[model samples]
Target: LLGDVKAAGTEVREEYRWTQERWDEYRRLAEEMEEAEPSAKGLIFLDYGKQTLTSDGRILNEYRFAGKVLTQDTKWWGTRAWYIDEGINRIDVLYARSISPDGTVHEYSPDDITFSEPTRGEVFFGQGTAMSLTIPAVDIGSIVEYGYIDEEYAPEDPELFQPRFFFQSGEPAKLSKCEFEVPAGRELFYETFLLDANDPYIGQTIKELPKFVGTPEPVITRTDSSTIYTWELRDVEPLIWESNSMGYTTIAPSVHAGLYPDYSYYHERFGRLHREHIKITPEIDSLARAIVGDLESEKEKIAEIYHWVQRNIRYISVKGALASRFGGHYAQITLDNKYGDCSDKAILFSALLEVVGIRSYPIIVMTNDAGFMDRSRFPFWGGNHAINEVWWDGERHVLDATGNLHRFPTYSMGDCDLYYANYVRGEIVYNPPIPAENNSMQSVTLVELRADGSAIISDSMWFTGDMEAGYRGYFEYMPEQRHEMIVEQFVSQRKAGGRLSDFALANIRDISKPFLMEFSYEVDDYTIEAGNYLLLEVPALRYSFPEIELSDPNFGKKSDMTFMRTHDVTFTLADNYTVRFVPERFELSNEYFDYVANYEVDGNTIRFTDRYRVKKLRIPISDYAEYKADAEKIMAYVKERIFLSEE
Candidate 1:
């Protein structure tokens, strides 16, 4: 985050200077890079950059690039976009000029920049507006330079202080430097991940790093009134693209500095605000009772209230002051309005649970898709969303009411494997990545092959855990009349001539029970024609594999998680045809994945059972070849067709 204060922002200095000697150094660096890495020569690369954090909590983020139109690929580098949150930060452009190859310069004015919706990249503007600028006239070599100061003189919450920096960028850099200056007596908790070769905890999260001891030791120097820490890197390479990569944060050379001693300190400060907003009134008590009136067990009662919040509260992205935005408004206020953001819903949910004598805490977290976060030792206020955690039956159940659709005790997929914290625990808690079994789908299908080369297929499916939320959430919004059309669309995806016949559903609305759905469809030309045989594979069956290519020898491992799926099917043929051929029965098991398929034949019917389980999520670089081979084999085996010779 660039800044956190609104009105009390910083201003850039009037005078700025750049030396001709600096340009000469950049030119030499660019020439060296072009010769060494020809593949990257046509792409843009950073020549020089510096990020400085002042003792007064202000930031000076600056950059200078080797700019040229060597190819169409480098043309896009002429434009640059910066996110400016009018409410949280005030940004002042220190200098934005392009020095032509002929030593002439063109500077951009205030009128040249346009404000629009902010985009998430190296910077997360956080629901703020963005300012973009397009450089002028760049046919030959150029040196583009720009710098800005983000002022957050006063933050909404003084206790919330997290100033982090990533030494690595999306593009290669010749020189990059970062400095942090804090008051001499002020202490900060910090950690660095994958920063350099000296880092022992590379590609691993070290939950137990000694306090204040970072691998890439900075140049420590003390001023009369402040302590300055400096870190520098030279000839840094860009992070190459990898399929299903966790995120740039996971691989970057970064350091996160926390103002507080630990997570407990931040919780003690903000948790009080959280409790203040969750005021449980008589109205909340009455509603809590009414929700679980018919429910029997504690799990049922919890499910009822959780689902009630999901269905009732409408999500509105509205934030006022810092207190209201972070701690949320009163529970009664959210209930009265019938709409609120993620934090508001979480506050209301926790309040209702308290009314029923249940212990629940509103936990703040950065979702899995966002990126990995430092769990607890360093208390950084980086979480952007809030959810509820209920303590019942000697266990904790994580629940999210924001998505507007989720079963009891089951988090939305994004909510899993998150860095979670709450005022109640006063400690660090991270929901480790879940196994495939935790979120799974099971299906059964019955098919009837007719004499005229047509087939009727009926599927009964059951979803559990996260998969349940995924399927049930989609149909919850669909009108009853469109259910048939939706099922028809799914069928048409498999076969063009497939038409929906009849369908039935169970537990679509009643999330307390496992989600179950049944649908049937008819397909024309169901089998391939041979001289004396009919050939066809099972209908309504497909595997869900990551779309990774085996073509790249330089490809790395996958950091993404896959799910578990099981399918059982029964197929019957007309009296005129015989069950002549069936796919081979096979079983394959490995550390990362497991697969088993069994095919049985009896009389004119064929039965098949298939189970695919992802034992582990990430496929490391060393295991990529083996994982790819097994994945490809499964894809091929599933495509094997059955040849039913006519008798």
Candidate 2:
């Protein structure tokens, strides 16, 4: 019963068949018990999963779920489990059994399982189907157990395998164990992560399991014979969601097992596979030429191509078998369809670059989970995202085609300064860091105070790099009416009861240039009037400074903070008013940041300028106090007011 239920490229035997009548009967029984009363504090008794790898390169995975439906709210847990895939032929739900509180037991054969195609949203273009069935005779205190097996050949490298086991779950477990069995004489390699070396229960069959040292580096082990690796955790507590916890994979105890000889094999294999699909077709060449028509500079040409891809190609997630996930479709197909996932878009862009004689390579990256990569853990399945890197102007530029709103030559903030897989080189590479100056915002404001206690202000703001990317993304996705509302809100927030007029945005669609926005507004009662005297307060050009308190317990000790800004303002008072008070020039500098502010008055005009920048993007936890102190200093300087009086 434990052997291969069905082999690859082999017919299923008659003994494994289940008739349609049996399925209908099980469905009827489930429906009859749909109204079962609820239980208190739904709890799971056991949850187990297992996987076996055969010498023939086929993976068989199995799972067993045993839980009690304590209450109506928790009925969904024990009702059903689904094994869904577009490649349904490779999936099989063996059987299900349920024992009621009164000791009556009911069993469901394979034929009792129901198969149906579920509806998917447009965003999921080519997702497959689902095979699902409800457990029979389930009620309060009932024990429901069901298991299924799935077999699939790894698309990229059949011999390469990645196995992960979580030692914790949302529900407390009495026992949890993950076991891996490989055919004898097959090369086996693995690394354990986030496990306590001091734990006495941890066991391994290999003699060369690296000693658990101080740091939590991956412990690598290799064996030639058929190997069995088991990781077990007893009396585990429920994993509670913390406010700002790192990724689950980072904190969870698990093992990554692979059969590949080295990282080089993965890189070479995937590089070759991906290159085969990146054909430079005639259509691609023509499109590239059209996009870069008569553009002399390489930067300009790249900008044009990058912009075109962002504007034209749509993003749709199509997850299925390994082939569809790893061996993405050709670039031409993506162009024709006008939609593709990250890999599809990356491949298409790479092909387009090739057409223009520009050298580029596809890079595997993790968008939000960069911590998953460990230098010691060399596996091909490192990254969940794929992007392209372009070589231009003697420098490398990372491009993410799915970033529809990002400006050319500047990638989204998450895409910058991260480690990615250089499959061609068979190693990991850290992307070049963007300077704080490149990711900056500058604003200029002119204010004219009237005798009527009202004022007219004209302001212009410019954004570059990641700051530009944010505004550009807003303009791209926001409708015209909503954009106007946002502008109005922006003006009102600075000056209460302010009205905006002549609002204009520049370089919103021009990806190669910085983003600009200019607006004129009038605020009522801008000055406080007291019996033949007026008091005017010059508003701060920038009101908020990023704050990261070192004392905050929830603050991630490993995280870093970065910020940069510049502002200049001029206030022209009416002839009746005179400058009464002005903040003196102020300067503050620390290891983490620098700030400079100057205020000047000449006749009826007051001028002020300020600049603040974070010296480093990554501040160690030990330096958090210094960074926080610098930020506070900058905030205090900006909040200082300049006063005007009527003569």
Candidate 3:
């Protein structure tokens, strides 16, 4: 079937296989497309996708598209396809041709297709190639349509299959469809998620579905020995990007289909495969020993090895069949290359820990805004990142080696409060939330009010846990000169005419200690003078939370609002001035969060200390009004000022 499809085209090319002539032609066509259509950079008219799965273990996937080239931006619409390693999957161009505005057809031949390594951005290990060709005669107002078939053979797990269908894209699609077919007796399950609750479903399926509720249950159907499912949506408007969104997968209407029976079955199978790839060799043992030499404690040894990989190995992104999708390279390959993607780094790091007699496993996780996994919905393929989980002192410590600038023992920010599937343990788990103390920022600011209203300010800050990781990363790659400039700019922003005098940083490289930064600057006309009184506006020494307006129509319409942070600041006055007034001490506590602030005057110095804690990671949308009221009280307290007068 795959061969017949390839033969239907004028030329058939193997996946990722391209000639030099074809490469030149691709480049030439890109230039031509750019010159002809500049505004059409993001124009995509039609995208049709299909996938066919057979009970015998053969999967064929194909994508077809036709769109106008309005500007250079639309050049990306040219032909491109990615496939796993040929050893595991075979890809062929069934047909690729373009129609000009004049209705002339230009058919591409297999000899004209080119193959090369897919670009890896910040990934270290990659295994697979890309086949791409820019359709000829692609000009303004011209319509181009091309498609290819990617057939994957999974003899090892013939019953394993999972497919996701996205109903929306960056550009509005005039028409789109998702089709799947499986041989008889192969049970099929599916669930559909709609971004907006108000959007209606327009797609059709052979099997009658019950009224859509929350994520509809899978509709099972079959004709004789084969089961076929089809969903079609037309005139889908582009998804509007939202700030702090959970990503397209969560926001767009889509369907997830799988053939596995349960989560444990999928977990155990994938875990076994991952374990096979992380076998520790003699070289790995020796290297681990060298890296952790004389490190007495288990914690120290783990930190040493984790930091070693982060500091030594560079991260490069590789999107291919094995490394990008289902499998990863061996530990030895990643160690020798000194570069690997998240999975490669995780595998090598896990192996190194194993050699040192430490129990560790590579776990799959979704980073950033990929959203959380639904354990109830078993056999779902959702995680896009891999990290290591080490068992030490009867506790599990989650570590991500990809954070090159992060300190050990501290998982990346936002990593907590999410679901993860442990490959070694063969179970799904939630990462423990970082304690408020662990994710804290402490700062002391000294303010000297001069007789002339000019003042000098010095600040000392200490960051720990995830907070430390963020600053450490910033300082690790930033140059000394740039650091100085950034400090100057920071001070200037707060004190309109502030001039940086001295700056120093400590404990940046010492991961065991909290990261510290100290800087002093002088601000001209820092205080307003009226008669014998000095008006001193308190400077915000730490990050402030943005105001949440409960009045907004869409406020709390989607996910909950959750964050944790602590900031402490102190201010002092010169001996020449006596403090006359200060904001009263106050405390606010609620189910979702708590804020405690106090102010005191000791001789010529006034100290202000406040602590804010978010008790719940997510506050239900229904609780937005209450959350906003509590947050507003904190904002009001921060706005308080102090008054001083010369004796």
The lDDT of each candidate is: 0.70, 0.65, 0.66
Please give, for residues 1-647, the per-residue lDDT of candidate 2 as tens digits: 11132221133335433345534444443333343312224444455666667777677676665555556655565455444443332555555666666556676644445556666666765555555566666776565655666666442345656666666555445455666777777655666665655422123111121222233233223456456666656544445433333345554555677776467767777777678778888999999999999988887877888888887888887766554466467889889999888888888888988888787777788754344355345564557788888889887668887767667766655555467776754657677445667677888999988876689999989876668878877886788778788989888888899998879888777676677889999987888665555555556455443336335422222223244688788988888887778888988887656888898889988888888776544344344566667667667766666666666
How do the predictions measure up, each by TM-score? Answer: 0.87, 0.75, 0.77
Which wins on lDDT, candidate 2 or candidate 3? 3
Mark the regions of model 2 whose C-alpha exceeds 4 Å error after superposition: 1-49, 63-83, 88-121, 130-157, 169-174, 196-226, 237-240, 317-324, 369-372, 375-377, 479-482, 527-563, 575-598, 601-604, 612-640, 643-647
Give per-residue CA lDDT, model 1, range 113-134, as digits (tens).
Answer: 6677755444122467776767
Give the TM-score (vs. native) of candidate 2: 0.75
Q: Which of the numbered candidates is closest to the native, going by highest TM-score? A: 1
lDDT of 3 by residue, 198-308 (tens): 423212110112222233333345788688777766555555444433445555667777876667666767788789889889999999999999887899999999888
Q: Candidate 1: minimum summed lDDT over ten consecutive residues — where?
A: 205-214
| Decreasing lDDT order of the candidates | 1, 3, 2
Q: Using lDDT as the measure, which candidate wins?
A: 1
lDDT of 3: 0.66
Q: Which ten residues in a row have the lowest lDDT in candidate 2?
A: 204-213
Candidate 3's displacement at residue 606, Å, is: 1.2
Error of 1 at 40 (Å): 1.7
Cα RMSD of all models vs. native, in order, equals 4.9, 8.5, 8.0
